[model samples]
Target: MADRNTPNRPRQRIIERGIELLLALCGSISLLTTLGILGVLVWDSVAFFQDVSILDFLTDTQWTPLFADKHFGILPLLSGTFLTTLIALLVALPLGLLIACYLSEYVRPAVRNVLKPLLELLAAIPTIVYGYFALTFVTPLLQHLIPGLAGFNALSPGLVMGFMLLPLVSSLSEDAMQAVPSGLREGAAALGATRMQTAWRVIIPAAFSGVMVSVILAISRAIGETMIVAVAAGQQPRLTLNPLVPVETITTYIVQVSQGDVAQGSLEYNTIFAVGLSLFLLAFGLNTVGYFLNRRYREHYD
Candidate 1:
């Protein structure tokens, strides 16, 4: 019996080691792939900057990368990206927070179980489908409501992106609200505080950090989004703050350049990398802030 047990133990150890080795190999492969992409982006962007001055790339108001007389100022694209993302966040945050409050504090348990999954299903839809919906459905609706709105302006696309990001913000916020202790709500009720008052004044303040992180994450998604902006927003890069006009974004520009016939070694080809680097930096900054806020102010209900 002892000899049999010894043999089985070795076999089990071999299987466990095999699983560990496989997991490590897979992790290393994923990390290397990510690093390779970043390295390539940096390499191409460096080539672009070597040919063009950093000041011109950053401050120039025009983006005429495809023109015979090219000016590679990236500010317009950056501004457009920010404008749309800001609009998206403005629409998403309030609606999402309200939905979260309803889900966490007001809804019956049976209703919540069904509604939560349905709401989360929004996140599972393809972004390209959302893009098409923006172009066809949302743009026309805006044209009816807001006269003088262009066919491919920032408002429709931004609004659609807001809808797309709503589920993310709502679900995360709901989780945070639910994390608030039941005792607090009971104590507030005992003091004659209404449910609405407790939710708005007491619970929301406690969950503000988590909700802020969720909002930041939604902003990052809006910024990185490609298909909706590309399909709905026009490809004209301009320095304009008006949401009613057609504006190009960094993601849209990247898509445009990638689909063109530019040579791999030319400035136009390398410009894609430059824009991508800017986007990467923007996302990284937002994520860093979100991470620190979550760590510093996350509530411990227990």
Candidate 2:
């Protein structure tokens, strides 16, 4: 037994060291991949800025890069993206929280088992499918309510995008609420607070970080969403604040240009990187703001 154990010990040590090395290698690969993407975007964006002045790119009112004479304004795309994202958040935020509150405070565990999966199934649906559904079903439904609604407008896509994000917000918010110490809920109840009052005052405040995380993630997802907005919101990048207008988002423009419509190595092609970098910055800024806001209201519920 001693002889066998001695041989096995050295072999096991070698295996353990090999596994550690493999994991380190895997982590390095992931970091390298991220750096590679950043490098490409920065390199191309620098080259693009050389041709299109940063001022023109930032302040240009028109974005007709594919035309004979180009206008490289980013306002149109940014506005569209913001419009759709804000609209989606307006729709999703309240509904998702209410759903989370109900699921956390009201529903039985058995019912949650049945309903949560069903809700999550929405997240599994392909974006293209949601886009088609928005185009065909949601748009028609909205036209009946709003006069002069465009055939392809921001509203339909925004509404569908909200629905697509609902599950994410609900799941995250519920998990956060669940993580709140049971003692807090019990203390509120012991003080004669009703179930609703306990969930509202006790659990929600304690789970503020989680709810904010869900909102930030939902906003990020909404901002990055492509096919649904592309299909439901028309491919025209108009600088209008109106949600009823047909506008093109940053992601839609990227997709449109990537379809071999623009020449390679041209200023237009370079704009894709610039636009993507801008988007990365936008999402980063949003997360940063949310972080500060969370910190402001965050409490130590103990």
- Top candidate (TM-score): 2
Listing every candidate in turn, what is its Cα RMSD in Å to the true structure after a full C-alpha superposition?
Answer: 2.2, 2.0
**lDDT tens digits by residue: candidate 2, 65-149:** 9889889999999999999999999988999999999999999999998988999999999999999999999999999999999
Candidate 2 structure lDDT: 0.92
Give all TM-scores, in the order shown: 0.91, 0.93
lDDT string for model 1 (1-302, tens) is: 89769879978999999999999998899789868878988999999999999999989999999999899999899888988898898889999999999998999989999999999999999999988999999999999999999999998889889988989999999998898889889999999999999999889878877798899899999999999999998898999999999999999998888886888889899999999988988898999999887777764422
| List of clashing residue pairs for candidate 1 | none
- The parts of candidate 2 lying over 4 Å away from their true place are 1-10, 288-302
